[model samples]
Target: MHQVYVLKRPHVDEFLRRMGELFECVLFTASLSKYADPVADLLDKWGAFRARLFRESCVFHRGNYVKDLSRLGRDMNKLVIVDNSPASYIFHPDNAVPIASWFDDMSDRELLDLLPFFERLSKEDDIYTMLQEHKSS
Candidate 1:
């Protein structure tokens, strides 16, 4: 099964920059129409790295909490939800492991702090190996 990584809120860019290095990242933006113009303007100013990543990514929009959870249910065991919120707050009663941010304000250094957690999760889940097998067969 393909491991699903759901990124929430402002962590979209950070998630893209970081996870893109190790995993195929699927970014769930709230609504492209809602912020398309502004986001585009920002992208023009900020540069196209994120835009490139966004283009070569899976985007899930127009979803509610229940809908998101249901989509995640298809591969709950292989899903890892990353957000800036506390893990306790983001974790549902259902099976979900959240990769919580370890800092008040997210930054490169702060994201680096999550490397250990990411390595641990990736090791435990064997997502890369599983994905390779699935792809090969």
Candidate 2:
């Protein structure tokens, strides 16, 4: 493949579809747009993400890239970020839902494991408080 190619994580489309039904999903990554945009298209061909943010949105802090969710123009209490990298959500630990890094794990069901919680979480009055109480890292 001379062109860059991306493989969709197993069941990720279903996961995104499920999450999309509950909340306004957003794609926030530290990857440069040139690379990330195409990957995003493949990952979200169903158009699950309500917004997409790229590397410019990241903050270079302490030699690690940090995603500042505060700039998302939304209430911090109602926001959640699921990422494999701790550095991505270091600025808002309470809002982070950590996942083990996956590489060619075709049988992975990490996304499925999260569905029930998100289903319940969408109804909560405050996500931040709920996340603190649940704290699954």
Candidate 3:
């Protein structure tokens, strides 16, 4: 048997709780369901994710597993993806909020810092416009 230990990101619970309240949050990952689902279940205690999408949901392009967000059947203008890997959202960079990948940095507050921005984002009509403005600023 193989046991794995997962560390929750700082303020991730708060982040998920708040994001759940404001948006129809979905857990989308390129990892296989067998691995990611259990971790998500452990991390998401508040039932934050309305849906969970696994590796099969991704589109493999140029040797990378790209999350083709258009397949999600949602309004593109309202869609937003928060991910650490740029390649994951290469197909829809306009809708993505690129985050730095986490790995054993206990002092990291990226998720916490994003709360206010996400709160503001929840009110915007066009996510692309807001993201573009955020990128420029």
Candidate 4:
């Protein structure tokens, strides 16, 4: 149950960085088609730092919406998709929990609260344990 955090905005980086301090992070950055060479150059420079932060991280340069979304959901069932707008378009179908936060309005404490559930799902045996607990209750 490796938790994959899909970050969609530039401003969300700060919050993502804070989360990385506590969890194993796999960051998904939007494509750089609009920015072209400049964006590519920046990613090349930033690649090293991104690599060091996680067990693995990748840049999705192709904005194949349907394909990427399908892959993301398949890769990890336990995901926290963070976005600045209503993510109902994406999360509604997958049953993923979306956390909406504006750059100026978001708080670190609020993000930290979700860590426990994310960590629990990342464990292989937690599903059965959770079911057992649920049945007993």
Better of 2 and 4 by lDDT: 2
Q: What is the descending lDDT order?
A: 3, 2, 1, 4
lDDT of 1 by residue, 5-115 (tens): 333334445544556566443333334333443454443332323322221132233333221433433455565544343322243323333344443443435445555
Candidate 1 lDDT score at position 86:
31
Q: In angstroms, how far off is 88's CA in candidate 3?
A: 0.4
Can you write out model 3's per-residue Cα lDDT over 28-97, one digit (the tens) per residue? 9999998998899999999999999999999999999999999899998899999999999999999999
Total clashing pairs for each candidate: 0, 0, 0, 1
- How do the predictions measure up, each by TM-score? 0.42, 0.92, 0.96, 0.39
Those runs of model 4 whose alpha carbons end farther than 4 Å from true positions after fitting are 1-24, 31-67, 72-80, 84-92, 106-108, 124-137
The lDDT per prediction is: 0.41, 0.87, 0.92, 0.39
For residues 4-120, what per-residue lDDT tens digits would candidate 2 score against the true structure? 877767878889999888998889999998888888887886788999999899999998889999999998888899999999999998889888888898999988888888888
Best by lDDT: 3
Pick by TM-score: which candidate is best? 3
Candidate 2 lands at a TM-score of: 0.92
**Model 2 spans > 4 angstroms off:** none
The root-mean-square deviation over C-alpha atoms between each candidate and the true structure, in angstroms, is 11.6, 1.8, 0.9, 10.3
The weakest ten consecutive residues by lDDT in model 3 span 1-10
Model 3 residue 137 CA deviation (Å) reads 2.8
